[model samples]
Target: MVAVRTARTLGLALALCFFSGAFAGVGTAQEKKAEKAKSKLKISVPQDDAELQIEGKATKPTGTVREFETPDLEVNKAYEYTFSVTWRPNNYTTLTRTKSVEFKGGTADINVDLTKADPKAPDKAVIRWVPTPDDVVEEMLKLGSVKEGDVVYEPGPGDARMLIAAVKKGAKKGVGIEIDAKKAAEATENVKKAKLDEKIKIIEGDALKQGDYSEATVVLLYMGNEFNALLRPILEKQLKPGTRIVSHRFTMGDWAPDKTVPVKGADGDEYMLHLWTVKEKK
Candidate 1:
């Protein structure tokens, strides 16, 4: 998990497990005041050196009950979290666990016992893959109002065209999480070819699983409706208020978007784009 942000960003902070960076907020007074009282998470297992990494929020811990605190979180917001446990003595076979929770602003105890589920379970793809074109990416970023200081992330960044475009459009940084190993390599190469090797980071991992976009200001998506539906609760819980989400051709089941638009693709095909802003859960 190396980052253009800094090589040691993850090496030291996450012990070469996962690496990421953060951005400061300059927002309305209410938003500024909400940046305290983080959610509390504690993971319990038999291993004292169990490396625990959660989804969405980014602070990996190691201990019997790996305890950590999240950054200021939205109240009544549903977020998806993943617990990635690695027992080095066992040859580093990773056990990944995912859960969705609605936390009110404050220190909510999220105690997870990883012993319950099989630590070696595999994951299934949640969405059929579809790549977003560069022009369509431009439209989505514009639709989401991606600009300077924004950090963009695409969960299933196919070839990373979306992130490459975000960096070019003045976004400070971009991250792409691709589940396919070959595509992830292809994306890394593409970013390098774009000379955005430093600005864009790629991860070859499960997109429908635990991963953090906590630093993201704008998130772009191109999954199907059901996939969006499955990810909606987690998105709402994990993304800070005011963060913009734009999906290329699908909408969250009943969570109406703030705006929706259609853009004609270069191939004479039309695509539907839906934009949603994370709101505090009522």
Candidate 2:
């Protein structure tokens, strides 16, 4: 009986001793580990009552981490954090932003709103009209020596011609005068050969040179392009009321003529003839 019981009892006693020593060492290690872990997570909050949260891949374990574990440590392995704070306004603006921020490491969006409207929006801008100078017109009106019954004749090309035509039309019944183009004179001569040259006087002089023609109702013009613009200011200043101006070929600078007549040429194409009048001061 003694021989059969000896081996079995001895083996059982040795196994029990090994297990007890292992358990004692494990308990001592657990106490030391807990103390270290408490010091590492020094998560103290400020005076402001803000929410604190944790986020990210480490915090929210997924994929292969589902079954992962440390043989010694019994702590949660995930890590994440979040906080709540007041957002500051920019510059002197009344705009303010408020947000609850997450600890995720990526782009975040913040929205802002204004407490009041922008002060600069109410400012008014100055606007001005850019027309012919008043002095220029005044100078023109001062030259109103020509009476309503005085003769006016068209001269030169371009705007000068237009003014001449306009003045002729606006002149008194027997006052306005017009000189047709050279081509018009030929046409007139073909129709009626007798006294055609006398009726349409082709004066070969630069009308720009100031002179006296009291008998004329208005001066008609069909002069060259360059001369027309050059002579405009002079004509406006010196032209008398009864003495009108008409131009056919070119236009004066920024001048709105009183009338426009469309003439059909030999080719059947239409050309616009402008007429401008010097009105009496209102």
Candidate 3:
């Protein structure tokens, strides 16, 4: 009986040891996973009160800089960090800027200075309000085959000439997005004057940040090369297959147009119009 009791106690001890070893192994794996899931980000701003958003979530700033840990990220996989900063330097003016960066699972730092103007940044003033002549606008619409059942979108539509003409040409709806507040208001007024207010809508906002253009069957552009390039990715990503993009006087970088045509403007000068159709994804 004594020998049997000793054997049973030994067996219990071995079983407890085995279970404890298994639990320890699991704990080590969990620790390693937690380490891989976190990344560090530090951002410096020009002002303490400047509002900042990291990955679309507002992050509080401490003094001129803020450091925080990001949420779970895949190990060694790069992720795009999209952030925006907004601040006011004076009572009359407010400024907002958005930028993006890519980061893997590691530490990253960025500096955003709103006090100094970015020389490379595309300016609305630089684009110049060159309205497509009435006849040229007609040709552009015709090139895109704008007609009934089509929804047309024009970005930076200075006075909304393109949208106005498109609606008059038989488009189901026309949408204009202008970055300049004054331009947007003027466009709205023009739409009302044309008595197409019900068919056209003018939005006052940055085209890049507006984020939705899937409803548009046709797009009209009269912006410069820089502006067109800036908008290229958004158009490619958001526009649906077979959507037609028509541009006057400029082209997106290296993206060959499906067709190009020259038309004489009412001003007596010849202008070029380019058209592209979004192809189905492979």
Candidate 4:
């Protein structure tokens, strides 16, 4: 009886071990299945960079992974937005995507997917300040009549960046500037030597509003054709008959000028320099 009881006990122990092993194996399989279901798409960007904005239906699903990369990453400035995306279950790997856009300044949107796919190129967008519609008309008129020795109308000194670029590209450029005592002290040595710091008077008020073109042989208009249209009547009456007006990257609107010259800007923007000499009096 003792030997029979021992054999039975051993059999029960063996049965328990087999069942436990089977259940343990099944539990691991289920856990892996759950993990596969939880896998998701990942989006990444660089730290300390500008915010990545999402619009439209993309904004939903707040739990989606967000990534960052900075403009500094692309030293070449070839791409405005760049990021890597991937997925779990080996469905995807780090994929690089990019889009091209105009130079208009603002937060631009870029969309992506979990499949690690390439997106179409971004539409041509402007990153710079686009003059208003009315300004567009005005700019065309102003740019059409541009000639050498014209004071390019710019509101802020920062606007000089464009003119400086044009000058670097061989456009004869000059500006009437007025510097304050503080600025004069810190002026570049060349500027001081040229007396630009003292003689080029910086207008105390809005330079565009001051209506002071007395010393201007020409007014280089960059405001766009719409604004030029509004200025058509003003130029018709105020400007000297032989005075030259030049415009950049705009078309002449309703105002018919004396002459037009086609030219390319530093960035290759096509512009027509229109010449209007007091619309020769009838």
How would you encode candidate 1's per-residue C-alpha lDDT over 51-159 as one tens digit per residue? 4555433444456766655544445434444555544333312334443333444546877776554424442334435677778888898899989989998888878
In candidate 1, the residue pairs with backbone N, CA or C atoms under 3 Å apart (3 or more residues apart, or in different chains) clash, namely 55-82, 78-237, 79-237
Model 2 stretches with alpha carbons more than 4 Å out: 1-152, 156-193, 196-203, 210-215, 242-244
Q: lDDT tens string, model 4, 101-197? A: 2211122333343223233522111112333233333444344444344444332222233333223333344443322333223233433455444
- Please give, for residues 1-282, the per-residue lDDT of candidate 3 as tens digits: 111111122121211111112101122344356544444556666578877765455654456666655544445555565556766544423456566655554444434443443544432222446777888888999999998889999888899889988888899899998878889999999999999999999998877677379998999998777677767878998899999999997899999999999988778899999999999988
| Residue 17 shift from truth in candidate 1, angstroms | 43
Q: Residue 222's C-alpha lDDT in candidate 3?
A: 84
Q: Which candidate is the best by TM-score?
A: 3
- Model 1 misplacement above 4 A: 1-123, 126-128
Please state every model's RMSD to the true fold in angstroms.
17.8, 36.3, 16.1, 22.8
- What TM-score does model 1 achieve against the real structure? 0.56
Worst 10 residues of 1 by lDDT: 2-11
Q: Which model, 2 or 4, shows the larger lDDT?
A: 4
Please, what are the lDDT tens digits per residue for candidate 2 over residues 1-282?
112211122121211111122101132454346521110111222212222222111212222111111112222222122211211122211111122221211212112111222233211111111112223222222232334454444442211222222233343322212122453344344323432232333343334443334455554444333445555665666665534454444467676666655555555555445566665534
Worst 10 residues of 3 by lDDT: 15-24
